[model samples]
Target chain A: MTVAAQSEVQVDNAEVRVTEWRLPPGAATGPHRHGMDYVIVPVADGEMTIVAPDGARAKAQLKTGKSYFRKAGVEHDVLNETATEIVFLEVELKV
Target chain B: MTVAAQSEVQVDNAEVRVTEWRLPPGAATGPHRHGMDYVIVPVADGEMTIVAPDGARAKAQLKTGKSYFRKAGVEHDVLNETATEIVFLEVELKV
Candidate 1:
């Protein structure tokens, strides 16, 4: 499958990793599992499709300025569902 | 001194604490030390003033969608310098 999003590492320290992700329409983060706890801050309002490892699917609404968090071990592929670009600031706890 | 901003806890887990911060003109987060490492995602374009623990001060420009991070033990009071409101998604690593 074609890659959907691009993530640029903004900061990497002993405590956490901050990545700025940009996803165009139909782009995706591919399949991956969270190695550690993480927080996501949406930079733009949009919709996303989540394809889970167990074949489950869901839709998530991305609201600008709002944030969410989840523990590690979750596995899913995140895809952009809107026509415009979507951006997010993802902070992964390393400690 | 009166507070310049308000923070609502969006998510708190074993690994991180996510706070949604809202700062109005002349609002401040008060003086405090970061007990843990943290990342900040700006929700709006604005300017801010940072008052250090030692009475030192500095100016910061907040651009919408941009993010930043810092290690633990940093002490500063964050104050909004613009006439408008400034918002941020702050994720503090706990683990």
Candidate 2:
């Protein structure tokens, strides 16, 4: 079984919720679906393996200080396959 | 006159707008107001001088990889007072 990644809720208010995720090598966030629109801010340069619900797989390259956004209802499992730990912040819009 | 900081839009979609901000020493973002709720993810440890419209000043300390959120209607001018360039991502939620 893959090790579970660590997630910490940094902030949650009326307008937004921010969570920080730390993924060690071989760690995974397990399959999940986003309930709200979200933005991802990568803390370091790294890559993640994205596994879709249908078993499709893809690689996501993340650069330090870069951010991206996605709409709600996306389902996937994120895995850290690199030797180094990967850290990122997920900002969920509550509006 | 304080030099103006640089802002680059990284992503703009129906749900969110992501911008990367770079502030060199003594650069400022000029006084502005936030229209949407937002989250800021710092790329490096640094300090910023915040100047309000009334000239009130405050200091904001930022940590690398850490994030914070604010509601809309926040108005201030952000300045980089350190010698090193400071970088961060501003994720605005378009609810």
Task: Provide the TM-score of chain B versus the true chain B for each model in turn.
Answer: 0.92, 0.95
**Cα lDDT tens digits for candidate 1, B9-95:** 988877778898999887999899999878888898888889998888899988987788887899899988778888888888777
lDDT of candidate 1 at residue B37, scale 0 to 100: 75
Q: Please identify model 2 stretches exceeding 4 Å from their true place.
A: none
User: How large is the C-alpha RMSD of every model relative to the true structure?
Assistant: 1.9, 1.3
| Model 2: per-residue Cα lDDT over A1-95, one tens digit each | 79899999999998888999999999999999999988888898899999999999999998988888888899999999989888999988888
What C-alpha lDDT, on a 0 to 100 scale, does residue A65 get in candidate 1?
78
Model 1, A1-95: lDDT tens digits are 55559989988877778898999987999999999878889999988899998879899999997888887898999988779788888888887
Measured against the true structure, the TM-scores of the candidates, in listed sequence, are 0.91, 0.94
Model 1, stretches more than 4 Å misplaced? Answer: A1-3, B1-3
Model 1 Cα shift for residue A85 (angstroms) = 1.6
Candidate 2 colliding pairs: none
